[model samples]
Target: MIALLIRDLRLALRAGGGFGLGLAFFLILAVLVPLGVGPEPATLALIAPGILWVGALLACLLSLDRIFALDFEDGSLDLLATAPVPLEAVVTIKALAHWLTTGLPLVLISPVLGLLLFLPADAYLWLILSLLLGTPALSVIGTFGAALTVGLKRGGLLMSLLVLPLYIPTLVFGAEVVSRGAQGLAVNTPLALLAGITAGAVALLPFASALVLRINLR
Candidate 1:
């Protein structure tokens, strides 16, 4: 599992391997939103949590198709499936790698983007915390979506369609945590809900992803 994890990380860091694409997309959203919404600090602050969470979610979605598409195309996924390691573990590892490359960076840099959105002082820590807790679910659910469509050409659109609905609960609770924090409201409930969603996705989605992947491989 460690070997597979390392291999996916290495591949993601290579040229055209999607290491920075999501981050770049995220940065672009951070920059463009102010222009579209006008430059009022008050308005920016009002919507910052929602904007940032949505941007992060969409950025994470941008690379879901690449999770297994490359390996499946090149026959590596088949080899992994036939190896001693369980396909469920392979799916879990890929989700972990994807989170490391895409979601972790987003979490680390969210504060910088938050500044652009004039995020409230109290919300900054919550924003980062919410993202850290929630982005793993994005990667895991995305892997399941990717597995379902890995064999189709132009599967990116289909993957997004399939996965966006699954993302709503996370998005709601995650953004709620930040929004409530920004308002200095009690955020324990939403924050706990966000954590629960992530835990459930991590524990259960890999099995579903692996099942879909096996079917696709056959």
Candidate 2:
């Protein structure tokens, strides 16, 4: 499982890998939104939470298809299915890899993006904390979507369609945490909900993803 995790990470970081693509898209969104919305600091601060959360969520989608597509294409997935490590663990590791490559960078860079958006000073910590708690779920859920569409050609669009609805709860709770934090309001409820979603997705979704992958592989 460790080997598989490392392998996936290496593949994602390699030249022409999609590792940088998601981050680039995220940066572009942060830069363009300020330009489009004009230079009003109050307005920018007001919308910053939603904008950053939405950007991170969409950026995650950019690499969802690649989670299993390359291995599936090269016939490595079949061998993995037959390996000693359980498919559930394999699915979990893949999701972790995706999170490491796609989600972690976004979380780390979000504060800088927040500055660009004129985000409230107090909200920066909440933004990072919310993203930290929410992005793993995004990766795990995206793994399930990828598993569902793994065998289909041109499946990326379909995967996005399937995953976007599932993303709403996390997005809403995550954005709410930051929004409330910015306002100096209580954030415990939304933060707890976001954490719960991530925990539940991490605990259960890998099994579901493995089951879907098995069905698709057959």
lDDT of 2 at 122: 95
For residues 102-195, what per-residue lDDT tens digits would candidate 2 score against the true structure? 9999999999999999999999999999999999999999999999999998999999999999999999999999999999999999999999
Candidate 1: tens digits of C-alpha lDDT, residues 1-218: 99999989999998878799999999999999999999999999999999999999999999888899999989999999999999999999999999999999999989999999999999999999999999999999999999999999989998999999999999999999999999999999999999999999999999999999999999
Model 1: per-residue Cα lDDT at residue 152: 94
Each prediction's Cα RMSD?
0.6, 0.6
Q: Native-vs-model 2 lDDT?
A: 0.95
TM-score of 2: 0.99
Model 1 lDDT vs. the true structure? 0.95
Regions more than 4 Å wrong, model 1: none
**Model 2 Cα shift for residue 33 (angstroms):** 0.6
